[model samples]
Target chain A: MTCKECRKRFVEARYGELNAGQRAEFEAHLQGCAACAAEYRRLQQTLRIMDQREQPRLESDFGDAFWDKLAAKLDAEDAPPAPRPPQRETPARVLRMFDWPRASRIAAAAAVLVIGVLIGRYFFSRGGEEIPLAGSRETLLQPTALEVRAGDYLEKSKVLLLGLVNWEAETPEAVALDFPRYQRASRDLLQEAGYLKTALEDSRQRRLRALVADLEVVLLQIANLEAENDLSAIEMVKTGVDRRGILLKINLEEIRRAQSLPRPGQTSGKPSI
Target chain B: MKDEKELIERAQRGEMGAFRELVERYQKTVYFLALDLCGCRQDAEDISQEVFLKAYRFLPNFRGEARLSSWLYRITVNCFMDTRRKTQLQTLSLHNDAPGENHPPELSLPDPGADPSAPARSHELQQLIRRALGRLSPRERSVFVLRHYQELPLKEIGEMLEIAEGTVKALLFRAIKRLQKELAIYQAEV
Candidate 1:
């Protein structure tokens, strides 16, 4: 192809608008034409040369003076001042009702008032010197024998509750026949008979009632085991309480209430059962 | 005083100050392009002012689909083209004094001076190229400046000039051919 024809197609090809067949034909011609090829190379170099010329850039801050002039013109065009809207009073007024320290003082005063009322009721209700719950001799004696008997019963009951809670059968009487631990514990605790009767009647001492109810179930199981000679039932009862976390619950509540109820001689140690 | 987007928004809202701010920001660049395209300081300033005023009036109509610079470039080129159409240049022929080859004006050595060229041999050649540029058609001159001098992508030139990409490429090719002819004359003389 002639240089003129090649140049015409070259422009079309450069823009990627030439159809595939036309482009192929141009490529084939360029492969064989020296003069057209040379012109094509020169045109590419010229493009390269032009592309190398950087846009003449001034500083980014070049137009500050011109901007100032424009700004002055704009500001001059603002409308004449009009009456402004009347401001409404602020609506969120709770924050203003009390200063920080005043709020703190009111809370402290209420707390002191409550404490005073409690202290007054405690002192005024008593006929004599208000005795310390820990040091009162009579208070100490009231629950000691009862707790000792309850503790013995609880040991056996703890095992039985463990079994019941775990859905295990009662420890068998045959096993009790061999393992005499329950009978021995019951015998040793028989001296606390008087307090047991009193504890059973008192509804005010709900914690004690809960403990007794747990023990009564264990005692019945023990009696049933001995009568039936069911050794398997005894072992089952023992496993139930352990699996159910029953003893831990009753023991924890009993110790808390028992410690609060004064003992005659025993000084409270570290606030325990 | 204001950012570009803020100025554009305010101008769109019919604020003259905002439009003027944009004009101030771009005046020098428009001026330089006009001077380069028209080959005279007076013509360049007139083209630059006209471009800005037209841009201000058209601010509300600008769709903001392209960069503000691209939009401004469109205005500048269009204004130049209008002027060129009014005063159609006659394509001047040169004596083939020298016939060997060198680079085109776009590829000529960089001009570090504020003036178009320094007192150097290459500078004289640059002056000759600038004169030759004035003779080309407005479309050809624009394509040359954008493709080579502005180093704009062909697609961008198409967008600014509102022409097809193929047309831009063709015009660029023709402009380069014209430049090569003028350079060939210089080469033969050298």
Candidate 2:
């Protein structure tokens, strides 16, 4: 080989990693060539000196000092890391002192607000459409059939609720109405309805249960008034019936509107209600 | 060995004391290796600190299949390489002995300026070799340092570098060739 090839092999040889035959050939070449021999000697000397060079030493206190400083910084960072707690944990507890006396009182207030909202929305969305009265020239009177149907819906709801709660000892017929046995079952069905106002699944069962719960509440109020034998209680019942009658009308309209919307299996564009 | 394993297990459980012990025991090796890779003392110190900090952060994920030193070295090398890439600063100046006319005995080498066999130049020549090493690519410098100066076996160097043995060999060969070229120039200058 040439001088460059020999020098390359010589470099490899300096590490004592050359193969035996190559080492022999390299030795012969080194004996013959003064420059290669001199180069080999110098390279060996460099390698030996490198072996003797001291590894760098760090400051003796580096670890302790570093940890001390780092720990202090980390401690400072961690001191106040937690955020303020949110107020949502016990919502009922928070509102306890400021709220209505009982669940029923809250329910009655909510019912009033809901009824007021529905009435206002209905008037606003109507845009003054002329609704003629029966046997009169009044341009904004509701139909008598609608009025009768509204009364029937409320009356039926009262009967159903009486059946739902088995409201009185005398109401054996209401108790025999195949009423729902558990409030939890009704709650689960209500959950599936997607709203208190409608049922999207098992509509027959949901409707029956909802109608029963409503009727039971009304009947329970009547029974309480009758048991007390108080005329003032009768007036309270009258007010409840009047307000509930209007809600039943609005709810029936909403139920009609919902039923008219496209159902899963029916192709008809019209509502069954 | 079981003590190390138990310590690692405790460290994995978020035990700060156990982790600190691990750091204290291994800090010297980590710092020296960092210094070897990055010639700047400050960069070495920084890399060493980062390696320990990162080890603590990733402690729970350590599976204990490999020695902690090997795993730590892997992280250290990555951290050093990342810093080197970001700075693009070569680290030759760290080895430039603190400037003084005073020379130590074991380190002396021949000086062409003085007697033909002058010993001071030998140490200076060794320093020159180290300085010229900075001109090499990090991979070449790494392979050269690990193979020659560190006297690490090629296979272990391959493991530390995460490269195939043949590739390490090729890189080491190229590095030696470059060093020889630089050394030849230095010899002529002398």
Candidate 3:
């Protein structure tokens, strides 16, 4: 490539989006030209310096408080807060209404089960129809939706935290880091991690469970990173991630999951959720 | 917890929770983007609030032709630009714009060179780089920040800004050139 052509492709080259042939030509041009090489090095160094700077601190309840403040502002203007979400009745909340002893709850459940069975038998006899088991059967044949969700959660967290888990204060320029992006992703993943942890509470995925719990602590640390230089906090988080080998575990689980994916018309010997 | 598409759909239906979720998802993206373009955290926060409020109001009409993040980003840039224009006009109002009146000198802006006692912090390049970023136009700053800080593709940034990829490239090139000039002093010290 000519010097002009090579210089024009710097953006693409810096982002590693150039095709192999183009990349090869660009590298060759840089190698042969001292001016081009120096310019390229300075560009890379500029980005590295950007990376080393601390991320701007955001309030923990920033989103929540913004919504409330906006709502109040609108209310003062006599414009009611935009339509509120429909209140959802959580199953746990519904169950809490019963507030009965375990024995009494079990007895009630048994009575309901007997009554349901009798009604089902009556329907089966009268309609002479088999129960529709297809939906449940299909779900059993595949992995729990939770596994897929867990996999996705783990994959995202792994990508987001990899830079953070590996960052060392002594070698701050080791990677082209984006502290703000990591902080945001960690905040998003924090909710998913908690949900997944609770969903996996009764499951057979022990390693997956532990990994997610570890991810929670690490992600929390990342999401709450203060504005100032808090190298000690980052180091503690890094140490926790390393001690738990969370990244390695995520990779291993992914491999395990890939190997265990059920083929068409076949089901693996996987525990049902 | 919901996918972005679902969140938008629900938020459009006047669901506060869904709108909140949507905001949570892209809140920082919008905040930092504003911060980079404006070079001030307080302005960034105001811009973000305005962007989200506009999203909440006009969401029912936000046809899903574009990604929600891109739409929000476009709103952020527009909000920043509008705020900047108003501030500029307010500042300029102090001067005479009638017919052929001479403009008054800017007395509000303190000169950096006026304070020699201010430690140079020659070892610190971050402050210098941050100040240099303030010299860029809104479009140039957005292009550079989205490309580098957000790691967005050039085409994606162009689409978000409603500019052609070539224009994005030109803007980014100019921005980097400016930064390179600023960083030269630091490089010389090394």
Best by TM-score: 3
* Chain B TM-score of predicted candidate 3 relative to the true chain B: 0.78
TM-score for candidate 3: 0.50
Prediction 2 global C-alpha lDDT: 0.58
Please give the ranking of all candidate structures by DockQ, highest first, separated by commas: 3, 1, 2
lDDT of each: 0.59, 0.58, 0.71
Model 2 stretches astray by more than 4 angstroms? A1-43, A69-273, B90-129, B184-190
TM-score of chain A of each: 0.30, 0.24, 0.42
Better by DockQ, candidate 2 or 1: 1
Give the winner by lDDT: 3
- Report the C-alpha lDDT of model 1 over A1-273, residue by residue, as the tens digit: 566777787666654657888888888888899888887777665554444333344446647654554445445445466777865556555556557565554544444344334434433455574322222334333455445545544544444333333321232221112124444333323323234545545435566655565555555455456533464775665665455456786778667756666688777653434
What ranges in model 3 sit over 4 Å off? A76-273, B89-124
Instruction: Extract clashing residue pairs from model 3.
Output: none
Supply candidate 3's per-residue lDDT for B182.
63
Of 1 and 3, the candidate ranking higher by lDDT: 3
Q: Compared with the true structure, what per-residue lDDT tens digits does model 1 show for residues B72-147?
A: 7888888887886786322232322234412233323454433554456645555666656754667788887766
For every candidate, give the share of true A-B contacts it also has: 0.25, 0.09, 0.32
Candidate 3, residues A88-112, lDDT tens digits: the string is: 7899867876746654545544544
Models 1 onward score TM values of 0.43, 0.45, 0.50
